[model samples]
Target: MSAPDERETLATSLYAHVLALRAAAPDAPLPPGGLPLPRGARPPRDGAPGPRAREAWPAVTTLVRSALADADPVRAALALERELSAAGIRDRHVYAAVAALPPPEEARDRARALARALTRTGTTVTAVAAGLGLLVPLGEPEDVPYLRALGLLEGLGDRAARALAPLDRKAAAVAWLVRERSDALRPLVDALVRGDEQAARALLTGLSTTPRDLGRRQARYIAEAVGLTALLRDGPGLLVPAFGLLARMSEGPEAEIRAYDEALTLYETVADRARELPPLLGHRARLVTLVQELDSGDARLLPWPPGRRRAVLTALLTAVGEPENLSDPAASADWRRAEWVHRTARHLAAVTTAVEAGGRRAGAAGVPPTSRLRIEVAVGDLGEPTGVETRLLVDGRPLVPSVFGSGVGEPPETVLLNGALRAGPQPTEVRLAEAICTEGCCGALYVTVRRDGPHVVWDGWRRPGAPPGLPQAPAYRFDADAYDREVSRAERDLGWAWPARRTAWLIAEGLRERPGILARWGLRRGWISTDFHRPDVTVITFLGPPLRPDGTPDAEAATRQFLRHLPDDGRPPRERAAEALRRLAEEDPRRHPEPGE
Candidate 1:
């Protein structure tokens, strides 16, 4: 193919993905002409220049190549830099150029330069957002200082949010956090400041996947920020982050203090904001007392009820037995705290039971509940996709997004069923050419859905089972109701078992084995508060004895196994505990491959 034709071919291929995104997420704000969907929102509306148009495809390609093409690449690079500065990053053409530029020595150099220049120059929100798209994926740790500045900005205000709405600031922040892997608080704070659509999704991905390790105080600070985001929204923010904070604060010793502080702050902010809003989001009179009780460190009536308040306290107690009483004797103090927890667990369990019953009735009502939805696509073997995903939920249906354009064949490992990428309208058919991983391998996840009168039947989307994991994605089946059903199951299951080590292991096993049914429970906000392996996995010292093939634990064997996973801290365990742990960790396969064998 000629150079223009080759560029056209690639652009055409990219355009197809864009169209698929448009078709799938009809509700998104489509942009004008052939521009890359800014932050995965807005492609041109119908009757506008579609991607197939001779004029449209080539223009984007021309813009991309012009910025990179060169006989002496550096000269062209300098010229592009001048042009970018002269025209200003705010120019619409800048975004098209930035989003489309093919990676090359010159492109990489230019992107870094541009990110730095744009950051220093203070571009418009759209320009800054578009600049982030280009830089986050390709920019290095050095370029972080500039991007970090953008991430640190507070008070974007409603107007700025609306202005950047087309750019999908939420997704951009998340994409930056995920791809850049910057540990700086700026990024998390930025995402929260903008009130990310699915704040928890971005926050969690960054927290878990980023190479950077964050401290408990910083984590607590983030917890406060997430709660602050919710408070700012008053009536409705992404509830996940707010709830996710409860989970975070519930973890670690003295973490409850952080949780209580965040909740109190949130409660105060919410009370103030609610007064400003049209009407309160649902009465939380009991919630006030819950916060007060926690703040007071009083173990009195425990006035919290069946909602957020109960969950928060349950998670806190579950993390660290109970608050200490300064008046109590030092040695016997542990016993008293344990006794308090024993009592609290019963009350919390009762509350959870009540909530579960109510949730079941609500869920059993059968109609699919109306709510925002986001789609996350996983790539690489990182257990999640890079920001190589987008949310284009049109009328509650996720489209295979254009964000996957750059990752067409990466063999999407998993498509996270949540995260509101941007606000848009809905369309009928969900036409996607994507990959899906199955059974720890990969295959294609191509599907074309159209309505069959009253409902969408995947009869149009009969994707076969895919090979699992990376490289080649398998065709996997999807049930839209899976999220709801899984949550219901988790609630019932969690309620059945108290906060025991066994409960955590079962939850993990449930996720790994029956992912379709219970996977979300492990990762989603309302589910497990701590990351999958936290206190529980460490509680491996707590892992019970050997199990029968039927999977029932053998108490005798469990004690032995517990000792095995447990590392000997400087201090020693009880003699029996030490023996069990040592035996479990050091069991000789030659002597014990099969106890009776």
Candidate 2:
């Protein structure tokens, strides 16, 4: 085929892949490190084009027309640099001006000639980058070597890859660049998804050794590409890197692993391979890390059903806990040993104890082997309607929206930790995701959390007063010890803590558990709400009151107290929260109600 025809064929394939991805997930952002959607003609954001740019547009067009009309490589290269500087216009705008002109059949040869000359001799890095950009619409197979050579220069790979995006041999050129520059993984993905097994292997090798900071930036895109699965079937040479990449993908966010279609299959493969293969340093630590994540409510593993998660965990334990593996003197020298090996052993032992205590098999107790619960605070986007709330992730999926209808957010962390997960022997009904109404009439979903022998179970889904029907959710049974570890871990995670949220939760907890604090002010019922003005400062509002003659809450008569500004103030959140609660308990409403109240 002609070079132009081959370029067109490659471009069509890439376009088809992008369309397939969009069809599969219309709402998701395109994976980073993948083919970028066309950015179109907007000027760069860092600075607007100078006024001289608009004035120079006609001159820029005449220059491009004359250059293409002449079809002389030497003159075209000289005119490109001279005219662009003289016109005082940007290269992108020049490219746009050139693309706008009607192309004659002869224009292809002329344009390619200019593209070659400009790319070959362009003086500045910026000029070379701009020359490559021109080839996006006009690049052909023969231009591949020049693109590859230019791409070898530092920070030029992305631009070279962009020009190569529509050309045949794109995978080979991109794969080569990636081996030299890992940052090129972003564009390498564009080539990998079109059934290029070579590019897939190249990507795995780059991801396996890339620095952690860069690996994280590339993780989600690595997960999105469909080609990596082929490496699993290739051989053990790639398996080690595959394991390394999986460990990285498991970090940061649930979305990274969730985006990967083959996650479960890969986990299963890793587990199966662990029992058969001799332990290597990479395999030992990476497998242990995967298992540790699986144990501590990694979100996906704990909730995985039919015992696949349990089986994977068991296989990992057998692999990592082998006497020969642990006895190695170098074990202590491994940096990740303390992080993964010790923790994994403890968790796996606990899981084993729980499973064995239930009976010979985990199923005997009606609980899966590695099942655990996670109470995560999901902070909605600022200015969005969704507010901060503690949510339940059964395994890795959200339980709130699935059970309660869509219009709900949970109570503060204090309310949930105090009432549900840590509730005593008698089942406790905790207020879960509720309607967003201010008056509190729309009602909320409640779950009964109770202990059943070796398991902690969440059952008895109910939505009282505001609605008659509730969505069906299974009774989640988690091993008691694993459940406790998760709850304790969440409580210690002050990562989510801020002065305002802490104060509001403390006040809310005080009111809910100790009604006398509110009753002392002649207020029988109260509601707690917090507005975080910033990360450090919050406004905790207590609303409730003296009722009207009709026995309904009279808004005008209600006690509206604002603990105006609770700043970080160099105090521990607990200390600050306690002081605010004490002040609320001591203040006399009749003598010192809020000014309007």
Candidate 3:
């Protein structure tokens, strides 16, 4: 019902919220006073008086006292009030309790006197009181005047003072100081010079649209103080702009060379002061041009001690001349005559240093160097005897090995492989092998060798019976020993029947003499051998008259039906024949259903 009572209720709610948070996170630090004061009033003061003695008590003192009491509640009721405040629970009854306190006429004057004393003395009490007034027990806008009069705004760090200023007045205060008190910018300038990045950023942002002269002066002061010639070269913004200015200066004639030289010296100094900045590439190029204009033997044109001169010369040559011939023939003689060799060596040394520096920087930044190789293989038509070749790619490069072979027989067959390779800490070999063959036959074949693991695998040929044009047998696995044994058996069987063809007596006397059988089929006429298996499907063209049983063609029906069904690609003839039988059964009327009956 009353203001004080309402404040108490809010305080109790805040207290309860804090308690809940603390309970949830046991390790969390307890809130100040272990509770929050009421939203619009301060906590009760100790040893001063109860509600019966207060009159016009300062809102800040009241908040501080109440918070202190809640932080150290004497009674369970007080503790409960704190918990309620922390939890944000409000009660009009708390306001009613405040209304019952002594009239303001009696207490207000005394509270002000005590607050003023504390503020002037700059005691912890003043800090607490100021914190309470600014942060809690938010009172009327007029209350801010009363607090400021007590000197609460004096003797605080810029950041802290800014933070403590009334939210609505902070921007206006900053604007007033920047306009009326130009010297106020000194702190900001000093901060920048000291490399206090946060302060410098704040100052720069605050005066973003200010005069360029002021901004440039501020930046220059900082650059000079911090020896940031590079920043000066870079110009205007965050980086030092001196190098950029020097580069601009260097563009004129010989008379301007002195100014350019001075700028370079400053740049070198800046570089020494800040080890991070590299020598300006543009500046280096200009130096090369100057050296080229001068006589080669001019001592002043040279850099310094022999080594240093060599380094400067090398950098200049690198900037202006063609690259060194690393692959030159008459190597020693050519290199001895090469004017740029010394410079090139110096440049290379610098490069090595730069690389080392980069590595160190990366290490410091906690970035790990990457060292991994990736291999990709595309295999096609795996199962068929006329299988597709595999292309192996390593790190996106096509590797062309001088010697590649498949260990299938006495003399290994040359195989084409594709891929790339990179030298590693140890030699890494990537072996590409097929794992399964589902093309010509229903069998698995695997090829293996010891090498680095293949990274990417792809199929170029689709398996038989799969969607047409889709990759089928990407890889196959084969047992080399078993494959060799099978090959040996096949060879032996074919070899044993080889000479049987030459024995005409054995063929005519021992076996039935059938001239037409041999001639009609062309088995004898053609170089046909049992060792080679024909594809299941064949298209035989007859150029002559069709043969009869007696080796003669009947003129009436000379062209007879000569359809020979063979297996499809990758399928055995027997399997094709079985499939054909199924097709025949389905075609028969007995096995078919009448259409639309």
Error of 1 at 246 (Å): 3.6
The clash count for each model shown is 39, 4, 78
- By TM-score, the best candidate is 2
* TM-score head-to-head 1 vs 2, winner: 2
Off by over 4 Å in 1: 1-60, 70-97, 100-102, 105-107, 114-131, 149-244, 247-597
Write model 3 residue lDDT over 347-462, tens digit each, in one string.
33443343335434222211211111111111111111211122222222222110111101110111211112221234333323222333233221222222224322221222
The candidates, ranked best first by TM-score, are 2, 1, 3
Residue 223, candidate 1: C-alpha displacement in angstroms: 3.9
Error in Å for residue 327 of model 2:
12
Order the numbered candidates by lDDT, best leading. 2, 1, 3
Of candidates 2 and 1, the better by lDDT: 2
**Residue 66 shift from truth in candidate 3, angstroms:** 1.1
Candidate 3 structure, TM-score to reference: 0.16
Lowest lDDT block of 10, candidate 1: 378-387
lDDT of 2 by residue, 1-597 (tens): 788865454333222334545566654422443334222212233564543546656776676667777757767767666666554576555555554554467687777778777777665333454467568678888887677555544445566666765574333344233433344554444455344666666656655432333453255345434344555765666566566566666532222464455677777776777665555554555565566456442324333667777778778777775333345545654432333344445545554566547524443221233344655554432221224666566764557555554334465464445635674789887666676562167667778888899888888977765554666778888888888766665565544444456666676666678878766655543444454324435555544554556555566764544334566566766788778668768974434434555
- TM-scores of the candidates in the order shown: 0.26, 0.38, 0.16
